[model samples]
Structure formats: C-alpha cells, structure tokens
Target: MRGSNSSLSSLSRRQPWKLINIADLPDAVLIEVVCRLSCSKLIFRCKCVCKRWLTLISDPYFVDHYLRHQSDKKRHIIRTLIYAREYVVRLRFHPWTNPTVVATYNDLMLCYGNLNRYCICNPCTMQWVALPRIPTYTVHRRSEVRVGFICDTPCYNYKEDEHEDQKGDVMQHNAAYRCKVVRIRPPEKGYYHFSFEWKVDIFSSETGEWRKAVVLSPRAITLNGLGFPHQGILYWLGREENGCSIIFGLDPFSDKPKCFFIALDEPLNDLRHFGVCGGCIRMCGLDMATRSLIVFYLKTEEDGKLCLSKRMVYSLDQNMYLDNESNVSLRPFDPNDEDVCYIYVYGECVRYKYNFRTRKWSTIVEEIPHQISYSFVHVQPWWPTPVPRLPQRACPAESN
Candidate 1:
C-alpha cells in the first residue's frame, strides 16, 4: 500500500494543472472572458449567466467597450419617431416600409413621431416609457431639442493617509452617473425675422426640477441640428459668422458653454448631425449644392486647440437633393464605426461608408424609411455604481 501511494503521489506531482473549462471557472474568470468579447455578443450572452454576472457586465468601462465596438462595426442605428400632421411616423433601417414608432420624449417620438409628442424607448430591452406632456408655451416655436444625463458632482477628497491603500479598488469602481434633459429654444417666427436669442434649459431627474443654463449670445446663433450627449459632454454643430460651420462642446460640470471649433478643409453651409465616433467627436454637413455630404473630424491641433478637420465629401445621385429644400440629417450608424455614416434625405435614408485608403464613399443602404428624428442611446455596462476616487494626497515638501 505504501508503495502504491508513493507511486500515485509521484504521478500527481509530475502532472500539470488541468486546464479549466469556461463552465468550471469561477465568476471572476468568467467575467473576464465575457469582457473580452464584442459588445453585442457580450450583451446577448451576459444574461445566460447568473444575476451576478449581469451586474458585473453593466460597468461603465464595459459600456464604453460595448459602444466602442458597436461603433467600430458600423452597426449602430439611430432611432427616431416623427409626429407630424395627424399621423405618427417611425423611421429605422427598413426601406420598404415606414419605420415603427416606438416611444416619445420631450414632446418628440423616442423612435420617430410627430411634433406634439415624442417617445422614449429602450431598444435592447424592447421597452419604452412615455415622456411628460410637451409644454405648450414653447412647443410650436422651438426649432431643436435634446436629452442628456446629469449627476451630482462627486466629493474629491475623503482621506489623506489611505491614498495608496485602495488604489486598485478605486480604479475598479464607477463614479456616480445621472441623466439630464436639455432643450434648445430658438426664436424664428415663420417670417424672415431672425431673432437670435436662444435659451438652454436642463431637467435633472434626481432633483425633479428644470433649471435654466446660460443663454447663448446672438452672435452664437449658428446651431443647426439637435444636441448629442456623450462622455459627459453635449455637442452641437454651429455656423460661424464667416459662414463656416463648426462644432461646439459643452461640459455639463462647468458654468459656461465653451466652443470647440472643428476645422474643416472646405467651408460647409449647413451642419446637421453630431455624434461620438471611436472616442472622438464627428460632425456631418451638407454641401452647398445639397447633392453631396461632407464629414469633418473633430480633432485637436498640436497646440492642443480643438478643431474640425475635413475628412471627406460624398456625393449622392445628381437629383438627390434637387427639390429638397429642408436640411439634411446626417448621423453615424455605429458610434464605433469610423468609416461609415448614415444620412437622412427627404423620403429615404442612405449610408455613406468611407474608405480612407481609397478615399471613396461607398453607398451601403440606398433606401431606408424616412423618419422625423433619430437619437443614439447608450447601454451602460454591468458593474457596481462607481464611487469617485479620492484626490491624491499632497506630498510633504522635500527637504532641500
């Protein structure tokens, strides 16, 4: 028996550790595995695991990764509901039929609807909630609207001596996040009277109240399209006095709305859609003739100045914009996709995928349903609510 036991011990010592199957791994290991996958796949498979896994995958970092991956794939679609006349109009990817009207928000369809009401729907969960009634005071005269999240500022200091004690722990946590609503009210009375006064109001979900931010100056009156919020910043396309269009970025945490001028190679007349692409800002505009589409990259110069660099211009069919008198809506289908962007014409939507190497714009989707509006919503990653990291402790003065 001793001889046999000795032999078995020796065999065990010589054998390598058995490879761990994904099914047999611990929760942490499994989570790491899921994190490495693409966002869509991660979201699809995350629920298969237990509730704990669901919670972990919702982390903001995971959300960031998922959004980034989706953008990279050029698969992100903007949902808009248009409410006009008496019928509700919904626009999506399908070209044969009208896009489905899902929900509404801030007197606008969350998907695609008319002017009086809008819907707010969660696409992934296939759920939606109706927004409050559109205030009659400003519903008719307003030109543009937007929604965003707002959170209370986190305390920057908590401890002095424990700075290095929980560095890893702090890095893993997510800071507090909240949602806020923004509305851009313009002064344009049907007539040629151009009242440049514009006001921005913010609705905080946590406070359940609406507070007015600083009113934009008349000289800052070149805002064309709706505002888009990403990475805690709200962005909009604005035209300068010289008729050149640029993008303006506003930090919700700050008091004044600062301008981040996007430098384009050529001058554009009307700017429409602005979105997040590969962690950078992207702006789309219509050419002077309205038959072509122009894209600008929101980049920073060597001096760290933010500017818009002209990326490319895509021309559609000759008569595409011949009779269309309204402005064009150009948005990025996938926030992660840097090569392709989607444009909304009068009755149809087209996708413009750019190949930087070839310097060409390939039309992907020729005909899509014409919806009134579209907005990009984000799905946060599974993780615990993040606590703000305490500021680094000031080091004691070094002795001379």
Candidate 2:
C-alpha cells in the first residue's frame, strides 16, 4: 500500500494541473468576483461577455450588492460634473457643460443657469429631460433661489432574493416610484413692506406638473446657502432678521407640508457650510477672529423634532498660516468620510482638508479654478441611476 501511494503521488506530480474555469463557479461566487471589479471594467467589458453576465450586471439586486461591497472596501471617488467626457462619448450623448449643477441626488444632477435653462440628467445612463421654465419668477442675481432634489426607490430585500431562481434574475420594482424637484423662492416684497412668506414650487415626476406652495416663517428668513437633502427631507440654511443662523426643513412627500425651523448654536459665524456627512446633516463654521473651526451635527429627539448639537471644536493649525484677514469658509463636506473636512480660503485661492481624527490640516488644492462648481456631485460608477421618462410639456413661453 505504501508503494502504491508513492507511485500515485509520483504520477500526480508528473501530471500537469488543471485550471478551474470561472464559468463553472457558483452564482454567489461569481457575484462576489464581479462586485470587486472596477466600474469601467464591469460596465464595459463584463457586460459584453455573455447574456447571463449582461443580465446579472444590469440587475438591481446586483447593483445593491455591488454598492455594499464597495462601501465595505472603502472605495469611493469624488468627481466634477464637467469631467464626464468619457462617459458622454461612450454613451453617445451630447454633453451639456454650460449649465451649473444646483443639486445632486442618487447620481442625478439638477443643472440650472445657462440662459435660464434647467434640466435633470443622469451622467451614467446618458439620459436627460428638460424641465419647463419657472412659472412666474424671472432669473436675477439677488433672487437667492434655493433648489433641492430627491430621487428615491425602494431596494430589493433579502427575502425577495431568496425566492428567485438559482440563476440570478432581474427583480422588478413595482411600487418604487418617487422623484421630486423643488424650487424655494424668497417671499415677494410688497410695494410698501416685506411679506413674511416664501414661495415653494414643487415639481413631481409622476404628474409632470409644477405646484406652488406657500411657506410661512415667524421672522423674516433669507435663504442664502445651498439646499441639502437628508432622510427624505430637504433643508435650506438661512439667517433670521436678528442675524441668528437657522435651518429650515421641509418634507416634499408630506400631505400637508410646512417649513420647520431648527435654530443653530449661539455665536454663529458668517462663514459656515452644511451638508450630509457621516450619515447626518453636519454644519461646519470657521471663526475668523479666533481661527477655530466649530462642527455641529443635526440630531432627532424622541419627540420626532430635529435639533443641532455641538460635536467638537478644532483649532486651526498654526502652520496653515490663516490670518484674520483670510477670506475663509467651509467647503462642501465629504459624505463618504467622517474624518475629513475641507475649507476654502478665497484670499489665497487654495483649498485645505482637515482630518478630525488626527486634528491635522493639509493642503488639497492650490489656486482654485474660477470656472469649477463648488457644489460637487458624489457618484458611484458601478451603481447607475436611471432617469425616468415623463410626458413632455411645452415651455411656458411656447404656450404663450
């Protein structure tokens, strides 16, 4: 028996090893392999390999799995809307580079301000639809219009996946259709005095109609900053008549929508920015006189009311050379990372990033470009959002 085992081992060593074919792997294993691939390779090369692969890659379930995998691996990238030339060329869609992107949600961009142009487009799918002009408001500099966008669809659950065939199949989203765009305009001033009301024009993708709503505030509010969407609610940063900073939040999906105000912490500085960071609404401000950065996080109480709490304060590193005269302001917050923050110094034309974990500051970019849009859109290439096609309506001018 020992001699036979030795002979078998010798024969095994002499024989060449056989390679395992990826096609022979199980569906779960194959999914894991595909999820690890880069977005470009998965979209361009993997999809073209076979019909099964094409169907798998395009399945909504697989997309969700891929996104989770990416997040687990901490793989994310920041990109500008203007830098989508390769995607535009590959998809054969005409690029619209002139309009400035006002809001980005679920990888879709709401671009405004190119000869009064407004549209929503998905860069990955290369699909776009032009929205009708604002009902009655004329474009002007001092108008201070705030725009917010939301595009949410229910994801496939694990229970639903268990019933599918061994070979993966695309799951249909039967009850998932929610997309909205809102334009918040300050109250129209009367000839004699100011009105303490605001006008909100809401556009629904289901109906393709622009409905107007009135938002009332106790004190006069000025919508000065960008509109950020968090947890199905859109928030606008503004100040009151007494120069106290406050946040106004509205739920577009509510049956009876009303603006809810959440007052910020005291001693608020003028140079502050709010955005979704660490899965919450975070606002950061820079104190010019003290060279200190204050960070505040929005939280919810048991009573279902929103409130802001001061998290921590970080003093600006002396090596940064930030002086009292420096025109400094908080830049757009990075949504994927909670440890990193960006601040823009207008006087020096440079952008710096601060690490909260280490409490260190470093320069990210020097000599900021004038043409670039500061409101950047974060996109995950592997997960492409489809732009819904709605019934086309003529522009107001055309109807006239």
Work out the TM-score per prediction. 0.51, 0.73
Tell me the spans in candidate 1 whose CA falls farther than 4 Å from its real position: 1-175, 188-196, 205-208, 218-222, 230-232, 240-246, 256-270, 274-280, 288-293, 300-305, 309-336, 342-356, 361-367, 375-400
Q: What is the lDDT of candidate 1?
A: 0.47
lDDT of all predictions, in order shown? 0.47, 0.64
- List model 2 lDDT by residue over 1-400, tens digit each: 9999999999889995789998888878888888878773446468878988888877766776776666567766554433222233432353455555677775677766445656777666556776776665645442366788876554232333455454343334322457788887655552122346877888877777678788787666676666777667777777666666777787787665667788663446653455555556677766656778877887756554577654677997666654654566666555566677677677667788888889888888544443333455556443565665555553323210
Which candidate has the top score in lDDT?
2
Candidate 1 lDDT over residue span 1-400, tens digit each: 9999998899989995698766677755765567556444446566667766677666545554444444445653433322332232223322213333332222222332345443344333433333333456656533344333333432121222345663322222224434445665554542122334555665443443455665544353356555665445566666656665555555555456443444343556456554455555666667756466666666555554465554766666553433664645554454444565555554444444554335565666644445544443333332222311221221112100
In model 2, which runs have C-alpha deviations exceeding 4 angstroms? 1-37, 40-92, 95-97, 113-117, 137-143, 154-160, 164-175, 189-195, 265-267, 302-304, 318-323, 346-351, 363-373, 392-400
- By summed lDDT, the worst window of 10 consecutive residues in model 1 runs over 391-400
Query: In model 1, how many backbone clashes occur?
Result: 53
